[model samples]
Target: MKGYYQGFLIRDWQECDRNNAANILHSVLTEYGLPWLPTGADKDVIKVEEFYLATGGEFWVVEKQGKVVGTAAYYPVKRGEKAVEIRKMYLLPEARGQGLGKYLLTELEKTIENKGFREIWIETASVLKEAVKLYESSGYQAASGVETPRCDRIYVKYLPLE
Candidate 1:
């Protein structure tokens, strides 16, 4: 499944390929009232590099016709354990409703499983109804509830590693 769609490539992030992905994330998050306009510190390209090189975290970009359409990242949550967190999953408006979210998530699960991760967690705002639906549709049961200083609702999921 290297290139599932025409000109679509889901592969590791590269340093030079930052602004587009970051812009997509910023745009998506802005819809939820979460402003993350990338400053110098939040350079998507550099963030990807650091996360991959320093923490062994995995970053994936979905490109179609040589243009980025979606992005997702996975990072270790507990040291010496098979727990990880899925973060920054976003897709462009034009790319929604085509089962891309589910596809990206399924790919992420496969990656995590291969990395020995048994459980995956995600956090999202309650107001984002689409995200909530996506999580629930993907078999992510609510493990716990959380209220953060900057966030309203948080949900977690545990995947069986059979």
Candidate 2:
């Protein structure tokens, strides 16, 4: 899954993309007042293959002019019937306000649904107002049980299986 979207190359995680992906995630997390815990919630950022692809999930990196600028990923979970949790969705400041976040989210939902995932979960902090807004506006309803130490809100959306 790779292509140019609005001049940005969106592609699956590659071995060479490890460092850049981690950096972008860390930068955005810190910018939003969240700690960069490589040994905790963010551990997957450094081991994309083992944490995502190897587990029937996916991680993507967005690049612009040869510079990595964003990431989006999701993995299977047991909280619901055929469910997956969206994680590691981040974008550099400069790459924001251009609909890339919305685009990535729409793309993720479509892919997840196509892959037979019936429900999607998301955990986020209130400080990330944009994310909260995006989730709500996209039909994700407020939920509970935020397992991440830094996240305070949870949202879940169920896809209609065709």
Candidate 3:
């Protein structure tokens, strides 16, 4: 994945991006008063590619002159699952409003669709109303079954795989 907006570069996650990914995840969690070292977050940030590649998934980061400013990833519910879940996507305050979120999401969606996934899901806290709207505007619909204490809402999107 390669994308740039106003000098911010979007690319695949590498081992060296570990600290940056963890920092971005930590910053978002702290900003929202959420736990910064939850089990899921810990595992993903430290070993992003390891977590995703095993399930044919991918993690990406947006960097400003080599410093990570945004993060996103999608992984299968199971190794051979038909659908995948989007996780830990965030952009720093300085990175928002530049359409980077939408741009990153578009690339992520294309990645899953290209990988032959028929559906994708994402969940978020009710407090993040902007995130909810972003998901809704991007062809995702309200979905149920996700009951994480960290999030109160789930949204899903279907793709036409060719």
Give candidate 2's whole-model lDDT.
Answer: 0.93
* Minimal lDDT window, size 10, model 2: 1-10
lDDT of 1 by residue, 123-154 (tens): 77777788889988888877554433334555
Q: If candidate 2 were superposed on the true structure by all CA atoms, what would the RMSD be?
A: 0.8
Model 2: runs farther than 4 Å from truth? none
Candidate 3 TM-score, C-alpha based: 0.90
lDDT tens per residue, model 3, 1-162? 577778988888888888888888889878988777647645767877678877688888888976789888999875224898898789989898888888878888988888889889898887777788789999999878774567889988988857
Error of 3 at 16 (Å): 1.0
- The runs of at least 3 residues in candidate 3 whose Cα sits more than 4 Å from the true structure, single-residue gaps closed, are 78-81
Candidate 2 local lDDT, 105-155, one digit each (tens): 999999999999999999999999999999999999999999999999999
TM-score winner = 2
Query: How many residue-pair clashes does candidate 1 contain?
Result: 0
Per-prediction TM-score? 0.83, 0.97, 0.90
Model 2, residue 28: what's the lDDT? 90
Q: Which has the greatest lDDT?
A: 2
lDDT score for residue 154 of model 1: 57
